[model samples]
Target: MSSGQGGGQSGGQAGGQGGPGWQADGRRGAQYPGARRRPRYRALSPLREHLREAFWFAPLLTCVGAVLLAGLTDLLDREIFAEASAAQTADTLLSFSSAAKSVVSTVSSAMLTFIGVVFSISLVSLQMAASQFSPRVLRLYVRSRLIKATFATCLATFVYTLLVQLGYDDTSDPARAVSVPIVSTIVALAMVMLSLALFVLYVQATMRLLRVPHVIDRVTRESLQVLQDYRWLAPELGPTPGAVPEGPTLLHEGRGGVLRDVNIRWLIRVARRHDAVLYQVPRIGDFIAPGTPTVVVVGGSAPRPRRITTALNVGVDRTMHQDLSFGFRQLVDIAIRALSPAINDPTTAVQAVDRIHQLLAVLAPVHLGELRHRDKDGAVRLVQPVPGWEATVDLAFTEVRICGAGQPQVTRRLAAALDDLLRITPERRRAPLLLQRALLERAVAESVRDEDNRAFALTPDRQGIG
Candidate 1:
């Protein structure tokens, strides 16, 4: 990963530097002086991000809604029972004295037991996903809406039944016994049936999570969405200028973690206010260590350290926000793991390559480099480093190419992928594809017998048909 910071001499000049000019040959240049100290700024909480991604948030809210509904039902039951004529009361009232309460109590107990079983099954699924696939995938299972909805339905039914049972009347006097909420009991039964159906759906959904295709598709969908939403480079936007010499201090703040996300909008606003240019050192997925500078600020008066720190939301793991490489990282991790000696599952690796090709195809035509954010007047405010086309291509194939060596199936699939990319990709993007092709050809030449090399060298077989 590249580290170090660069700045521009003028605000307009900053936008001209289309990519990271400071770093050459995938290595950082000499380090500049340390950053000056400033007032402490408040760090934004990741709680909201967590809540949005959290599986429990939806279910917890559902439980609260269910409680409110139960109370409304209780009120209606009281009003109807009190106003009903003798005939109506006789029609709706249950014949058993207190059997309604017993039935609800029984159903609630069963729901509680079922909740335990559902959770146990979910835990087992999680264990399998973590052990067999990457542990990073645990978030997908934990935050699944289907899983959350299932748990919510189960809890809602239990709460509704328990609440309805409280209104059951078993008084000694026959007149008082008529107060039982028979309508509420019927609704509770309906919820019980719904819960049963949800359980089946939940099982099917969990099973799908365990499948390789489903997992890769989900990640690809999310990554593609991020690419579409950003509107990265406006059509009217002009070319960026070359970078200026380093002047402002480099800010590291000695913080370290997997960079989960950067609030780009917030960073833009800060840069505009301070009339400064900011270059983010690491892309979203790159890990940073303590004492490593993450951002280099140039121009304007030095902003408060907190302002810079608050704009970054670092965490223990990478998220899908703005970090397109992380998606590739997850799929690549699975591919290499499958190629390992112990696993020896080339088919699984091939499956991953198919998805990786899909992602690269989506990314191929898009403009990727240091993203420049401008104010209303078109003056550049923030300039953050992004993975260039070549870097992203290398990220997609380098590891798999190395790990899958000597395995004809994996190598052939990779070659076919590169061939496809080379044809579809624009002229500027072809260099990386050509480079990957040459590398794969050399690997095949060294690993396979001369007779086999010729077969593998033929126009890349996307499906490894040979």
Candidate 2:
């Protein structure tokens, strides 16, 4: 006999508090009136992640390379100076045993100073990037990056020049002697700084340029309020089971089949749920009207006993979890908003805020659960399953279409949003207050999109605000 054990879990009828799941006024009850509302998910942002990685890597590599190059150049310069002048300037002297040794020494000293500055800047950059949806934070990040990149470029150039001088003779022509260090360091520093600068500029300029944040903010605020309102409602009612267990009959059995034939499995499971006999249905999501044969629940034989117990520990399990997820997301949004400054360009700060809003919306499912209703005669019926539980589907940033050849909308949006969100907030945050403001923003955007769409459809040349 095999050592492995086999078991099957029994399907039990778990009772739910019966009634309609959602009340028409958009309130589950007094407690969770508007809590069912979920935000629409737009997409993910990758620009911040890329920026963070680049920020850290650039400085680390620059520091190490600069020091090594400096030391080697210093040694060469020492020998040249000694030979040319018949004397040595203290600054031009090299004490290391070899050019490699001098290079290492110069690199170490310069790196010690540069790393401290660059690393600190990188840390701030990362924090701001993570919370870049807030205008205040975005500004801080942009400023810090600008300052660090600028300083690092200068420092790297200076240190690299000094180290390069080590590799040449001081007496060689004074002009030529000066040219090598200056050019080498300047070129290296300029290359690094320029690349980083473009990124920073893209982020800052795009944020103010795009105005996506404002739209996002409005959508998010409306969604959050709608979801929050739902939490105040009464609990959902679940479907009631038939009076007793009805079937152990095999509807269909198969060992192998083609890919499309897998529909047989679903038929069997659905039949099992109803304790009924079933056959394959060709189409899905088709409606069954009154008197239609949905499935035949076998009533002749008793179902086989299952090894596992048929019981449930069900008090606010998944429903609470879902609600909490929405709640926490809302809180996070509020926190981000609280951290945002009032004054920022719409393209940068507003778009940044909007992106976060969209992210939060994606978490919302159309409906949470179902409710069953009972008529005066005690006949049971499923009133409705929670409606509109749509998942916001999207690929992660890198997974989406990208071509190194051109600017990407997601990255462009990210850069802009980050710049605005990182700015320092000029005022204290009031969570509830912000929520109201966001609601207003949502209303405005909704009206704009609707009106614009209508106007554009009506006319070729738009007259005014759509």
Candidate 3:
């Protein structure tokens, strides 16, 4: 990693240098149609990211909002309804206090039941998804705004109805209850209706978990988006992902976790302040433990370990934020699991290969080898390591190829996908695909019991069998 080179990287990038408060279009002026778009991901604040993944966060927020809304209805029942005279609207305010209580009482109870049922079904879906596909798919349910929205609405409706029910007077005469909780009751009814709609939608969304192809498609789309965003930002940040740490090593303290992603802005700022170039020691998906080397300073004095560690986000599990390889890991896991003797679902394995192929195709033309980051003056400030083309391709196909070698559908699809990727990728990037093709042929030869089936398995077929 050259810290001094500024020539080839000075032109044709989308905008910012992948740092915080950095401008993309050379200047941060008013927005335009062709303005640089923000990458699909940046390093999320560790705490905020954890909270977002929590199951109760959205429901808790909605419950708080429900409380505030209940207070507003309380004010309306007293201020607006009590101020009305008998001739002003005697007939309009004539709903029975018992009926008001019953409406809310029934709604609140039903909402709780609906919540219980929803939770039960979601748990069952999680189990099925884990058994049929991969356990990581549970994160999909967690990150889903639809699931959160449905739970939030259900909880909000329950709380709102229960609070609204409290305002009704059991002793108030049925015909003369001008202070009836009509406004509050109407709002509660609307919430219940909304909850019901979301519940139906939630059922459909969770049911998607049972459909293997839908899960494969969703993961593929997510990976492609991550690829596009990484490609967009990588050019401005570095020239290649193969950059190695060269200076005084900075080590992580206490316990360490998987290197989820790095805070690019903080790292750039720290490196700039020290007049140094920082090279990240591990790939994004690699785990680092206590005393593990996290970053190394090349030119200037290395910053304190805390400063460097603060920019490196270590977490319990891998995420798609920047570790594009994690997406490949997921698809491979599904395929491998499908090919397991307990499951023997070759169709699901084929579907997983289809998605893996899609991602590999998108990645083939992109440059992921560059892992250099530069400041405004075009001097390299940070050099980060990322999975190389060979490693990424291995992550995509090695496990599936080995596990599904005996299955004709999976092997054919793998051969087809690898062939397609080789055709489209540049010559420099073709070695991994070609090597993998040879390995697949070997696996097919060793695994297939008969010569006829071995020949068939080695045949490339985009449709798995056709």
Candidate 4:
């Protein structure tokens, strides 16, 4: 009995020793035999990331440009309009009296009114999108260059016209009337016209936001660009697989939200400098709460917590920068919302499914998983978690499939989408596609009557016409 107890104690010690090497969430360790540790560093500048996501960044820039342009025009007025010959020419050219005050004032007032109208239209569109689609759609609007440009131009025009109006005072002295900067006034009038043109463009853009196809297409385009930007191919040597040395686990302390992006190159550099391997806990789109373990260090002393926090850009919502699944989530949200009883718009759901199929097809050929970053010396230093093809596929379709149950059009389109994925996906990845097809088939069986099942069970009809 004593020997048996001793054996149990030995097993317990073995288990204890092994515990730190493995993650509770079942992720593989960073160290693997026959794998060289090559650290890679690819960090997006925080300032650039902030600028890209900042709603005011573009507008502020436009305002600065307008100010500089105003200064240039003022200089032109001083240099050319102050000359006697230029003044004589100005007399022959367009010259506005103090009466033109009303014209400049009118333009400025119209610009202000136009700005309000543009904002009102945008806010209304955003509210509708948030309710009908998803609150996440608002990010698309915020990041839209067109929207920003429109706002900037309108605001810039208002400020310019107001400044120009201030400079125009015919009543002060008749001699100074010739130096009224007629050219600046004409430019302000042109700006007023431009603002009117932008108002029309803004209306068109807002209308596009209400269309499901347009929204889905926009998300797909953005996500594809992100995929291209990251060049998410598998590492040539693959991940090192073995037990990692136990080190510190860095818990996040910042305001909790979605894990949007990580400065991978920076993390790789830090890991290499410290002779450690850092494992990111949450995938890009995963929500991280304050105090959650975010990065696990192995093999050496951990870097400062602030360094890790700064390397990661957490936000209230996900973006396409590094989060591939966000686009899928947005598309799926629209699909399921369409299938909801209140909406009951199966056609829209089918449209979303088609786009999902396209995105999945693009992702099928790429490598997806924990991305390993290698340092200059070809040693792996950073291990960041990313959704594999299977996870992405699941995310793309699972919820929509469940929510779309009983909708013949949505189910048929889903079946077609799975079939397309299977056709394009390599044989090695066919298992997941097949499994999804089976799940979808089962769902169809339960939700649809046997008569309808016969049709859905056959080769999927893209139009649900089978």
Task: Assess every candidate by TM-score.
Answer: 0.82, 0.27, 0.89, 0.81
The residue pairs in collision within model 1 are: 8-244, 15-240, 15-241, 16-240, 16-241, 17-241, 41-306
In model 2, state the lDDT of residue 46. Answer: 29
Candidate 3 structure quality by residue, lDDT tens digits, 1-466 = 1123221122234333233222232222222244244564346688888887888889999999999999898788766566654347544565444576788889988999999988888788889989989997778877888888988899899999888877666545535454667778889989988888998999998888679888888888878767756654445434444346456888898467898888876787788899998877888888999999888788988789988888888888888888778889889999999999999999889888888888877777666655556665666677666677788898888999899888899999999998899889889779988999999999998998799989989889988997
Q: On a 0 to 1 TM-score scale, where does candidate 3 land against the true structure?
A: 0.89
Best by lDDT: 3
Model 2, position 58: C-alpha lDDT score: 48
The alpha-carbon deviation from the true structure for residue 236 of candidate 3, after best TM-score superposition, in angstroms, is 8.2
Model 2: how far is 192 from its true place, Å? 7.2
Candidate 4 C-alpha lDDT tens digits along 337-403? 8888988888888888888888887777654445555554445567766666677878888998899
Candidate 1 lowest-lDDT run of ten: 32-41
**Which candidate gets the maximum TM-score versus the true structure?**
3
Per-residue lDDT over 1-466 for candidate 1, one digit per residue giving the tens place of the 0 to 100 score: 1112221112222222223231112123221122112111122358976875676787788789879988887777666666653555543454542566777899999999998888898899999888777887788987777787888899988888887776667564546554657667777888889899999999999889989788878877877666543322321223433353376655556377877777656776777788887767777777776566666777886676667777778788887766667788888888888898988888888888998998888777665545665554446666666666787889889999988877878887898898888888889669889999888877777777677565664446777556
Better of 1 and 4 by TM-score: 1
The lDDT for every candidate, in the order shown, is 0.70, 0.33, 0.77, 0.69
